[model samples]
Structure formats: C-alpha cells, structure tokens
Target: MSHANAALTPRHRLRIARLIVDEGWTVVAAAHMFNVSWPTANRWAQRYAAMGVAGMDDRSSRPHRSPNKTDQQLVRKIVHLRWKKRLGPVAIGGKLGLSASTVHAVLVRCRLNKLHHVDVRTGEVIRRYEHATPGAMIHVDVKKLGKIPDGGGSRYVGRQQGNLNIRATAGRPKNNKRGRVAGITFVHTVIDDHSRIAYAEVHANETADTAVGVLRRAVSWFAARGVTVERVLSDNGPAYVSHLWRDACNELGIKPKRTRPYRPQTNGKIERFHRTLADGWAFGKFYNTDSARNNALPGWLHEYNHHRPHTAIGNRPPMSRLTNVPGQYN
Candidate 1:
C-alpha cells in the first residue's frame, strides 16, 4: 500500500480492507503487508464494512485545552521591562510586584531571557578588586601620554609654568648634548589602595618637583573628603627616588614605599588604574591638539570617579566606596 493510504486514516483502512477481501489475503497477511497488527486489520475491516473510510481516521494525541499556562499580560510586561527599561528580572519583578521566579518564568516562556543586547566588541567581563578599609595603602603613578597637536600652525609649542615658558625642542638622541625629550605629557595619579578612590593631575613634566606638587595636591584632595594618607607606593623611577620626593614625604609624615625594579606588579593598584585610563580615555580618541586632549581630562576623570560604576565595589562608583555617605553608596 502507498504511504498516505497506509497511515492510521479512514482511506488507509479502506485500502487495507480491499486488499484482504479482493486478494483473498488472511487478516495476519494483511496486517504484515500494511505493517500493522492483526487486531488493527480486523477492526479496520469491520469499520470499513459499517461506516467506510470515514471511520478509519485516528484521534489526535494533543489535549483539547490546557488549564495551566503563564499569563500573557505578565509575560509581555516582563519582556517590555527587560528590553525597554534594561531592568533585570529581579528589578522588574520588584517594580511589577511579582516574585523573581515568576518574572523569570514569564521571560523564559516569551524566549527573551538571554538575548544578546550588549555590544560584543566593547562588552568584556572585568574582574572586581576587593579591598575593605580606607587608607591602608595608596597607589601612586605617572602616565606618559602622547602630546596633542596645537592648532597655531606650529608643530611644537611651550607649556607655561608660572613666569616660565617650557618650550619643546627638536627631537634628538637621548644622550645628545642639545636634544630634549619634550613631546610627552604626564598625568600624575594617586589612588587609594583599599577604596580605589582616584586623584589625578595633568603636568607638562614628570620631574621630581612635579611629582611632589601632584602628591601634595592629591593629599589635600583626599583630606577634603575625610580620608587620611598612610603609605604612598610607587615604582622605582628617578623622580620617585629624588631627595625632593623623600623630603616632601618626610614633611607630610607619609611613608614612601617603592616597588621592585623592573617589576611593576608590586605596585599593581595604581598600575591597573593606568590601564583603565588608557582603555577608557586615551584609546580610540581623535584630537587635533594636545591642549584639547588635556582639557578633556577633567571631565573624564569626574565621570570615572563619580558617575561610572565600578564592578569592584558592587557596581557602585569609586566615590561611593570611599565613605558611608548617602547618595554615594547603594
């Protein structure tokens, strides 16, 4: 028999009955030929004699109605809150007065729970830093950044310091008698080792004098927020090893700590800060002049310290982890 006529349908049973009656085939033979049981063949033959092919159709396996199902309105609300408001199921459930599991069930039923919504190129899982107390240690470092081009048609310009104009000279060998390294600008930064609270200052030079000045400003900056400085850690750079730096640390009663030579990981907290600065600010930036780049620093730093959430502090801003002030934490 053909596949369509061999199925458990009215037409199939009629074909089987005709094969058995006209061909003189036994019920066992008809069942074997149709790939069905002898009882099924006999029953179909009886049905074909009484009600014909119309009685051979099989009953559906599905239930006529489902009594238990997720609410459509709740599922719609879950999807809307997730995609529109960017709220997780827990937050959505809290707002809509539903349990998290119920919200999750609705999302799963709607097939909208694990949708890829974030940009894959920029989306990376960053590990959080864990530190409890404030002022246990402080990370200090200087980041050298590329100079921004000044718009006045000149390739090089001078940065003014008080009454002096620190002019940039032509590039020459480091050991050359007349050459000077003036193309780089430095951002001196200090971060609390425990809270990751940061303080930064832009400077034209990375000399010991500039380092000392930035450190002083950093101390004052933290002091304004009721944080005290105990230990300042840095790499073994010449600026950090100078007498001026030591004298300044002594005057301020701050312990000066140095990392091992060639191993920056010893002072990792501030080093990691530099990595964040480069990735979050310096990378992919387009600027016509160095002054413009420098001008943008304050805004970016402000955002990083006060607005940008740090995963290290349970998605709270760095300033929030600094103290127990309201509107700062949580």
Candidate 2:
C-alpha cells in the first residue's frame, strides 16, 4: 500500500508504467514526467509487464521465506512450554535443547515475550475494561509516596546523603516524616471511568476524613464541568469502608462500590492512573522538599487531564472524551 507521504501512489506508478509499455514512451521521459529516478521507472515497467497493474502496488520488504528461521512446530513447542510453565527463554531453551537466543526469537515472533500477557495459572489473557460514558463511574485510589529529603535526596545528590538525611530526621515525630526524607505524602486520585480524566491531591494521611475531603473536592470538580458522579469505585481500604466516606458519597448522590477483598483490578482505572502519576510527577523529578513535590501535583494534574494523550481513548487528551462537558482545565 502507498504510505501517506510516499513519493508515488500506486496509481501514479501504474500510469508511468503504462505510458512506457503501452504508449512506447521512453523510460527516461516517463521518469522525468513523474519526477522519479530511472531505476524506479524501469522497475515499475518491468513489474507491470510481468503482473499488470497489480504489480505497481507495494510489496512486502520481508523476504518470501526465512530459511534460517526456527521451524513452526519448534516455535509452537516453545510457546506451549512458556504458557504451560511460564518459563523464561533460557529455561525453555534448556528444556528443548535450543539456544536461549533462538527460544527468545521464537517467543518474540509469537508475541508471547511479555510476562504480563500470560496468566500464571491458566495462561489466559488478562483483559481490561472501561465504562461507556463519562462519569458513569469514578475510580478512587490512594498512593503513598516517601517525601524527598531537604536540599534534594539521593536522586539529586548521592545515596550517602539520602541515608544521612533519613537518619537526621529519625528523631522527628511520625506525622512530620517526609517520603524517603522522613515523612510520606498520600496522593488521593479520582479518575473518570471512561475518559480517564483525573483529579489528584497530596495529603498528609489516607485517613477516612482525608478520603472524604478528597472525594468532596473531586465531586465538585466534576460537577463544575457538568459530569455527575453516578458511582464511585475503590479498593476495600479501611478509609473507603468508613462511615465518613460513605456519608460523603451519599451527600453527592454517588453510590460507593468496592473491589473484591483481594482483587484490586476492579478499581484498575485509578490504579493505572497512579502509575502514570508516579512516573510523570511524583518520582518523575527531583524535589528539594516535600512541599515542592506537593506543589508539582496541580500542574501535572492539569497536564494529565487536558494535555497528555491517553492510549485507551485513541491517543487524545482525556478532556477530549468529556464530550459536551469540557473539563475546567480545558
């Protein structure tokens, strides 16, 4: 197929080739008319003579056959062994009397290279889900981050300084400790189930009162943008089960739902958002103090909601999926 920016479309190639073969136009003249090279014109003409117009289309760059490629039966065995035992390439190779590199190549070709794709027990795929509409459900989760040390920690300085910073603050009270520094910051995130639009805040603790407060702010934030929170989903954390949290949900007319006791995937949307938050903001950069990291959350949240493209939603910003209701940051 012709690529978007290709020098010549299939039609152009066919036209040039036809002019040379049927109309007896010289290859050089045809090449000049099409603004292509002599070899290009010659190849197209030969292809057309051999296979007609169809030959003007692009062909696979890959060879017709790879003689050195591992046999299909052998490849299947490697895949079967991988799925059955969840073994690494080296282990599978050893069992099958093949080189580790060869087993890896087979696994790569079969798209069975990633451990996450295979279930350890059943070897079945782990599928994902998304709600149908914005605000149909909101995934709420909390991520605890160790605060950076004063004047920056190991990431900014050296490991020795980081340890010294931690030891220096060991005498401080529990509430005062910063992440890695001495205490921790609990990041409460509420992400729209469909659009993946997220609202996040860093708090001192993940107490029931803190969760309730965060939920109130998140609901108000969504309400301002015209998305009513129908339901809220979260893990079965103590804060989530508290009467304060439930009362807060009732006040907003949002039903509270919890994931199964040990299954966090039921609230996977916010869980995934937490990972993004960590990579893009929390630990994304070095901060001199806990306050600096906390300060970065607002800006990063804005970027995540209004600028960062979400892969699950067709690579458009989460705000784009908000439909008629544009986000506040938008």
Candidate 3:
C-alpha cells in the first residue's frame, strides 16, 4: 500500500519522471512543477532512466539489510515455543533466559502477542470476532474495588494505616465477625464491544436489583448517545443469572447472553476494561477517603469516554464512534 500521507501517487511520480527524463526538463523545474523537493524529482527521474516506466511505481521503504534484527533461528525458536508451550512473552523469556522485551518484540512480529489470538487447546492462531456495529453487544460486569479507608487505602497510605482503618471499622458493619476485610465497593460496568464505550457506577452491593438497575441506566446512557442496545453479554455471576436480570432484559427488549462457565475470556472486553479502570481511576492517584475516590469517577469516566484514545478503535476516543453526544462537541 502507498504511504497514507504520500505527496504523490505512482501516476503523478510517473508524470514527474516523464517531465525530467523524456521532456529534458531540469530536476529543479520538474520538482517545482510537481510541488516536490529536488531530490524527490531527481530520484524518480533516475529510476525511470534506469528501469523505464516500472521504476515510477511505489517501492517498499524497508531497508534491504537490518543488521540488528533477531536471527532467523532465534525467531523460529520463539514461534515454536509459542505453539508448543502457549507461553506469554514473560514466561517464554524466563525459559529461554532472554529479556522480556526481546521475547515480546518477537511475539508481536509473529502476531501471537494476545492470548485470544491463539487457541488455548491447540496453540493455533484463532480468529476472534467483534460486533460490527455500536451497541450490537455490550458487555456487563461488576468490578469489586476495595473501598479506600476513611484515611486512605494501603495503596496510597502505609499498611499500618490500612490495618488501623480496618481495626477502626471492625465494629461498624453488622456482618463482620472478623474485620480483616475493610469493605468493598461494587462498580457496575458496561462496555460496548464495537466502540469500547463504557459506563460504570459505584454501588453498595452487586445484588440482582442493583445489576438490573445499572443495566437499565446503561441502556439509557447509550441511547442518549444515539446507540440502541441490542444485546447484553455477561459472566455467570449471581446477579447475572438471577430472575431479576432475565426479567429486566425481557422488559427492556434486549437479548441477554452469558459466557460459558469458567471461561472469563468470553467476556474479555469488560475484564480488560476493569483492569484499565483500576489503573486509571481507582488507583490512579491519592485519595483522602473512599468518598474522595468515588467523587473522581465521573471526571475520569468523562476523560475515558471523550478524550482517552483506545487502541482497539485506532487510537480514537470511544465517543468518536457515537452520534449526537453533547460532550462530543466539547
């Protein structure tokens, strides 16, 4: 393929070459006529003189020799390890006594970087599918976040403060006979498979009613952005399998689908989003308290949906895929 930002097509280059080589125009005059640099025009003219018309065609820019490139034998060994052991870059690197980055580069070159790209059982490249349109299938899941203690969580604060906060809250909750676990905040998350647009809410629990309510709101959220929800995909969690969830889907006229048991990969999109949520929002920065952390979700969510570039969608924000989003203009 021609470079996306190429200044001239092969036809235009051929014209430049003809002007310089056939018409006997000066390289400077030809470059000025074609609005190209002198070297560009001269190079094409030289190519045409040497190889005739075929030389005007686009050629690969890759160097003929890459001295630093990994050896062919090493590349084959890396590929063999991927197929025979189904190991990730880190694991493969550990076994081969190579740097993880070197192994990772080989894996990327071989197109076996993502686990889903390779079948688990056969170690063969697998074809993965996605919904072709927005809202064709939205993934729903609950991410349980450890609520920051009143004085901040261990992530930001010291473990001593964490234990103190735990001990301080031990007698507060009625069900906690042993107060080892401080508390958990359920973050109901919904993500579109096509655009990777996401919606999330922090709640007290992950009950059937709460899940249904989140689903209802999430549908409305997408609708406001001009996307109609056709289906919902989720794991076999207690809330997802409940009658309330089924009834809610039925009432909303949306199809509900569940991943096969023990196969979290079936709902991989949301799972990956949850990891991003953890890194970008929940643990992105310091929080004086859980309430402070909760207060930051909307702002981060706004940035994620409207400004943050998603690699799956070619480095554009998810909002780029939607219509009539009021925030889109802003």
Task: List runs of model 1 lying over 4 Å from the truth.
Answer: 1-131, 151-182, 325-330
Question: Could you give candidate 1's per-residue lDDT for residues 1-330 as a string of tens digits?
Answer: 235544556666778887776567889989998889989898877776777667666647768886665577877777777766667789998998998888888777766666564322322222344446776678888999755433321223333321122133234124532222235778999988777888888887899999999989888877777777888888888899999999999998899999888766567678878989877776536545557777787778888888888876788878876556434422
Candidate 1: give the clashing pairs: 148-289, 148-290, 149-289, 149-290
CA-RMSD of model 1: 19.4
Best by TM-score: 2
Expressed as tens digits, the lDDT of each residue in 127-217 for candidate 2 is: 7777888889998998988777666778767887886776665443454544345766788889998889898888889999989989899
User: Candidate 1 at residue 52, lDDT?
Assistant: 62
Better of 2 and 3 by TM-score: 2
lDDT by residue (170-278, candidate 3, tens digit) is: 3345454355456788999999999899899999999999999999999998887778899999999999999999999999999999999987877888999999999
> Which model is ahead, 1 or 2, in terms of TM-score?
2
Q: lDDT of candidate 3? A: 0.86
> Lowest-scoring 10 consecutive residues by lDDT in candidate 1?
161-170
Give the local distance difference test score of model 1.
0.72
The lowest-lDDT stretch of 10 consecutive residues in candidate 3 is 170-179
